[model samples]
Target: MLLKKERLNDILTDMAKQARVYVPVSPDANDGGGVGKSGKAKMTRFELYSPGTAPNFDLVNTTMPPKDMLFPQTQKMYRYGFDTEGNAYIDIIHDSDEVVIFGMRSCDARSIECMDDVFLSMGYDDEFYKQRREKLATVAIGCASVAETCFCDSMGLDPNAAPGADVQLSPGVDGQSYVVVAQSEKGQALVASWQPYLEDSTAETTQVSCALKVNGDGLKDKLEQMFDHPIWEQLSKKCLTCGTCTYVCPTCHCFDISQENKMKDGERFRCWDSCMFSAYSEMAGNHNPRPTKMPRVRQRFMHKLCFFEDRYGKTLCVGCGRCVEKCPVALDITMLIDDIQAADLSKAEEVA
Candidate 1:
């Protein structure tokens, strides 16, 4: 099926009538200049599509990953309160809206697979994550242009395809349409609805390749033996421990659970957390094991490359380049991988 560029808004308008459609939005307006107060451009991110809202399909990738839709930054678990008769009541809160992520890239699609491992697999299922995952649909677009910092190909992802997405869209000839393929029942239903806007025609996809590449082969094995090595110390020296990398990462899923209370009611919630923060590892007795920046920095990278692979059979980093593009101090993960590949592990300590 070919989805023409001219009919995109109409298709979106039609889809929005049934579900909350999220598309990458870039506010590069005629007068807005797109710069936010933080000096960063009003960056591209998945936004809920409403009437008259413009979705930017030209963007390579969103600065903010779409992970927030599935696993929110601060999700209220439940509410508890005491009634006037002194009876305690509890209410479970689950906000599962039928949603579709349109125009997501392949890296974004893979990251959702990673989250599935953490939340829905391994003989355990989180009700909160399951609630959202079950109702969500993905429409991934093939990358026609690669960013300078993009390394998805090196991280074992295909830039031209998202196998996990329900529907895959790739730019067609002359950039006039998208070659759409439905890979699932949900995708079939979605594409069926777009039948009014699609054409029964065949077309070729515009292929693309990432400019940045890294040798990640054996990186996990090498890092396992180098945990106590001096490389971590060297890498930690320049890091400001700002946790910007985790915030912008597509696969970083660490979170902290807490609660907010009112006079007679309270709600438990979980918000995104960062291992780069010293307090994240603080014990109840104030015994901080990862008290210094060295261990904190080591934990972040080790989890991304080694620890996560050991548990999930895949690396956590999706190579979306959000961290690389947003990092204030130029602390790049590709550079770290390069360093680890070159490190001499002759006397490297055993895996911790």
Candidate 2:
């Protein structure tokens, strides 16, 4: 089913009425008051307030991933209490909120898809993640403009095609609005229920702008070939071990689980973790497997590019380039791979 622009807004309003509607609405372009290049100015970061939390859908890409919606930064796992009568009880809080994420990019959607596989795996299924997954619905908007650091094309990811979205929208040729299409049963029901505002699909629906090359597969093979090379040490030298890359990445799924107690009453909690941390793989006896930065760096790529694929038949990276742009050392993964692929082996002897 297809929905026109006006119909889409009506559907959004209806969804909002039923549950919390989080759309991508652009923020105020100009600040209320600020100094210009002096006088101790309070500069603004547009990412500080994302449209993803707004009611209107008008922003480009959200600075942060939608993971916060599923795996919240801070959430209570369960509450416990004990009476003097010697009765103890624990109340586990399983989420039951309906959430709708609009204007999410295809890469971000794919990131969720990859995470579902991990979070829902047997022997360690996360109940919180499952609850969020059951209540969340994703609506993807195709990319009309590509960022310089974006290389989803190299990873064989299509910015215009979101296999994980319940509903997908592309800009129409007329440029007045979007050409929306439903990819899931939920989306079809949504369009059908909001049929009063929807319109028939037209020829213009096929004319969306193409996403640039991600080259993820090509880069994966090249990385595999150079796995044992010394490039990791050189590229990772300036790294601060901040773990910002994994935190921002859409498909990085490593996490740590810990239990907290308050005098006989306690709860277990799960939080985000990363390979960059020195304590990530440390054993109880003080034996650390991946103690060095280079090994940790190597582990990140290996897990995403090789190990994940072996398990799930697909690479974990979506080629969003968040790691490249957010790295403190200016370590661009794409540029790093490009440099490695183009490295001249023979030149080392002559230079020596």
Candidate 3:
């Protein structure tokens, strides 16, 4: 089924009636048509859709990943307070709302799959994450074009495909229509619901390819032996340890849990944390396992490349290249992959 670009708003309006709809909007959409206070262009992020909300399908990928929709940056776990009789009470907070995330890219859709492995698999299920996951339905938009930094193809992903999405939207031959394919029961139902807005048209679908490329072959095995290599020392030198990469990454899921209390009333919450931060691996007595930037930087890359592959049988990175584009310094992961492939392994014993 094909949907015309002119009728997208009508389709979205109807979908909103069934579930809370989120669509990608230009970060500057709310910036009053000017640069932000920092004098930099705002990065696109997903926002709740309204009648006039314009979804930015032209963007390659949003700087802010859609992870927050399911796993919020700051989530209140529970509330604690004392009764009149001085007895303490705790109220668990588990809020779930049915929602549809429209206009997600293939990489972002894959990121959600990575998150599912962590939260839903391996004999453990996070109720907090599970609730939101169950209530959410994803509709991924295939890429019509890619950014210069995007290398999803090198990561074994097709820029124009999202196998994990409930519904997939590919650009039609006309470039003004979308061929919608429903992959799940929920998605089929959604399509059925949007029948009024859809047109019966056959159009050729074009597959987009990423411009950037990297060799990830044997990279994981090489990383297993290159833990102590001088490459990390050289790479970590320019790192600012700002954790911007992890924050922007679609799959970096590290978090810290803490509580806020004032006058006998308190709430336990979890916030996003980065391994690059010194305190992330710090112990009770101020003993830190990863005490230096070199090891921290090495850990971040190794986890994305080697450790995660060993555990999940897939790399943690989806290769959306938000880090590559957003990194203040030229810390490109694709470049690092090439460097790793070119590095001599005979000196590994000496580094060890």
Candidate 4:
């Protein structure tokens, strides 16, 4: 099926009636005035669709990943207060809403899959995350152009396809249309609902290639052996411990839980946290496992390359390159991968 670019607004309008439809709107295009925490223009974070919302389909990737749609940066778990008899009471906050995220790229879609493995798999299931995940549907768009920092292909992701997406929108043979393919029951229902907006047409999809490439073959194995390598010392020398990479990373799911109180009333919430921060691993007695930037930096990369793979059989990084593009310092992960590939494992083994 082909959905004409001109009729995108109509389609969004129709979808919005049943669910909250989110489209990729640039901050400049959004006069609605809700900037993200990064303080930069919310370049590509999915925003609620309005008639005036202008989605930038030409953009290679969004400045921030679409993880916020499922796992919010700050979520209130429950509210607590005391009764007149001094008995404590709790009110569970249920804020899940049906949502449709449109225009997500292949890498970002895969990031959601990574999140699912953590939130829904194993013997545990997070009720908060599961509620939102159950009600959300994704419509991923294939990339027609690649960013200089993007390395999704190197991370075992296809630039032109997202197998995990509910609905896949391929770049059409022409620039004004998208080839739609529904991959799930929900996606098929969505397609059926959008029948008025779609046309039956066959078109060839455009293939996209990333400019950046990293050899991730045996990367996890190599990282497992290079835990105490001196390469981390050199890499951590220039690091500012800014935590920008983890914040922008799609699959970095570290968070801290806390409570806010006013007199007797309080609310417990969870907010995103980064391993690069000095306080991230700090203990109550002031005993920090990763005291310096060296171990902290090593832990961050090792988690992305090794620990996650060890547990989930998949790398934590989706390689959308938001970290590569937004880092204040030139701490490139691609360079780290290259260095690891070229590192003397014999010497690392001897040191270990």
Candidate 5:
């Protein structure tokens, strides 16, 4: 099913009439905590909220990842109580309403699918992630222009490729139309429901939208032998150990679990955590697995490029480049990959 570029929000508002619709909303003064110095104007910062105005579809990328829809920063699992008989009762807090995540990028939507391998079918199953995953539908939009920090190409992601979107919208060469394709059964259902907005796809539209492409097949093997290369040290020098890179990363899934208590009743909450922090993996005895910034840096890349590939047959990174722009030290992952590509690793020991 193909939808017109002009009717995007009309379709969204229609969906919202029946279910909850979440689009990327830019920051207002209320988003970043308090008012500015004048105390009158709301300071605008980057935040993801419900769309107050219609979305700007031609924009490159969003400030935040679409992870919150899949793995919320903080979610309540259940509430427990004891009656007079001391019998424990628990109430599950589940997402009952259907949610449509409109105007998502292919990279961001694909990242959610990558995360599903870990949280859904792996050794452990998270009821929260599973429930939300089942309740949500993703509508992916193609990138019209690439950012300076974007390296979706290096990660073998196409700016126009739709890996995990239920429905993908590719802008036509005419610049006024779109090519819509449904990649899944759910996507097909969605397109069928929005039949009024869709039209038949044209071969011309498909060819024009995906002109940008990259090959990342040898990336994992390339990173393996280049682990000890000098690029690691050079890149680490610019890093501030700030967690922004992972925090804004669409596919980075490291989180910390904590318990909040109130008298006899305590609630367990999980929030976003980063691997860059020195205390991230600190044990009860204060022993840290990653003792230095270099190791921490190494851990992030290795996990994204190596460990994730080893486990799921895909690289963890979607190459959205949120880290490149958000980092205080200007630690760019694309440049690091380019440096890795330049290294002569014929003599280095291979890593699996």
Candidate 6:
């Protein structure tokens, strides 16, 4: 099946009529946004699609990941209050809507899978996250172009494939159409509804690959041995702890819960948090486990490369490179991986 490039908006519009469709949009067509056939990184973002939305399919990756569709930055878990008659009751805020994410790249899709492991797997489930996830459907548009920092392919992902996506749209070599394939039952229904905008023809998918490469093989083992190595100290010196990496990351899922109270009413909510902050480790006695930069930095990387994999059997990082592009101090995860792989663990162990 093929979806003509020109009819993308119409197809998206059709989907929007039934479900809330989110698309990768160029904030502005003339603002050096990722708008044309060949993608540019000026700025691309995911947003709710509506009439006149100029969906930029060529964007290699959005500055922001679509993980927010499932896990929002701030969510209201429930509302509690005492009635005028002094009756106490709690109102569970069940916010769920039929949503479809269109034009997410493979890495972003895999990030959702990582989130699924944390929120929906491991013998427990989060009702708030599950509610949103159950109602959401993914429509991934495979990458036809790669950003300079993209290393998703190197991190065990096909630039042209999305894990667990409902529908997959691989761009044509000529960038004029997309070869569409249904990857799930939900995808079948989605494709069926897109029949009017699709053509009963075939098109060759673009075989594009990321030029950036790194050897992630045995990275977890290498990181485990280098826990006490001086590399972390050296690396921590440059970190500003602004938490930009965690915010832009497609797979980072740390959060903190709190509440808002009025005279007789209150709302409990959870908001995104970052391990990079010193306050994250602060406890009742004011003793911070990861009080220093080195430990905090070490914790972040170790969790991403080793600890999560130990528990989930998958790397926490999907290698979307949002952190690499957005980090203020030029602290790059790929470089850290390279340094770890090249570190002399034998000598470090001897010193330890």
Candidate 4 has a TM-score of 0.96
lDDT of 4 by residue, 36-61 (tens): 54365645577888677788777888
Writing each residue's lDDT as its tens digit, candidate 6 over 238-315 gives 999888999999899999999999999999999999999988889989999888899999999999999988898888
Candidates 4 and 5 compared by TM-score, better number: 4
Per-structure clash totals for the candidates: 0, 12, 0, 0, 0, 0
Predicted candidate 3 versus true structure: per-residue lDDT over 101-156, tens digit per residue: 99999999999999999899999999999999998999999999899999998998
Quality of model 6 by C-alpha lDDT: 0.88
In model 2, what lDDT does residue 210 have?
A: 34
Judged by whole-model lDDT over C-alpha atoms, candidate 1 comes out at: 0.90
Q: Which candidate number would show the highest TM-score if scored against the true structure?
A: 3
Predicted candidate 1 versus true structure: per-residue lDDT over 2-95, tens digit per residue: 9899999998999899989999987663235555543646767888998788888889989899999998889889999998998999999988
lDDT of each: 0.90, 0.70, 0.90, 0.90, 0.73, 0.88
Model 5 TM-score relative to the real fold: 0.85
Error of 3 at 34 (Å): 3.1
After superposition on all CA atoms, how large is the RMSD of candidate 2? 4.7
Model 5, runs deviating above 4 Å: 28-52, 81-87, 199-203, 206-217, 226-231, 344-352
> What would the per-residue lDDT of candidate 5 be over residues 1-352, giving only the tens digit for each residue?
4566777766776777766777765444234433564343331222233434546565567777878877877877766666568777766777887877877777787798888988987678888888888988888877767776677766767778677888887877677777778888988888888888777656345331232334456778887776676556666777788888887888988888777766545667678888999989798899998888888898898888778898899999888878877888777676666666667776344421
Model 5 / residue 156 / CA error / Å: 1.4
Q: Which 10 consecutive positions of candidate 1 have the poorest summed lDDT?
A: 29-38
CA lDDT of 120 in candidate 6? 95
lDDT of 3 at 247: 94
> lDDT for model 5, on a 0 to 1 scale?
0.73
Each prediction's TM-score versus the true structure: 0.96, 0.83, 0.96, 0.96, 0.85, 0.95
Report the alpha-carbon TM-score of model 1 versus the true structure. 0.96
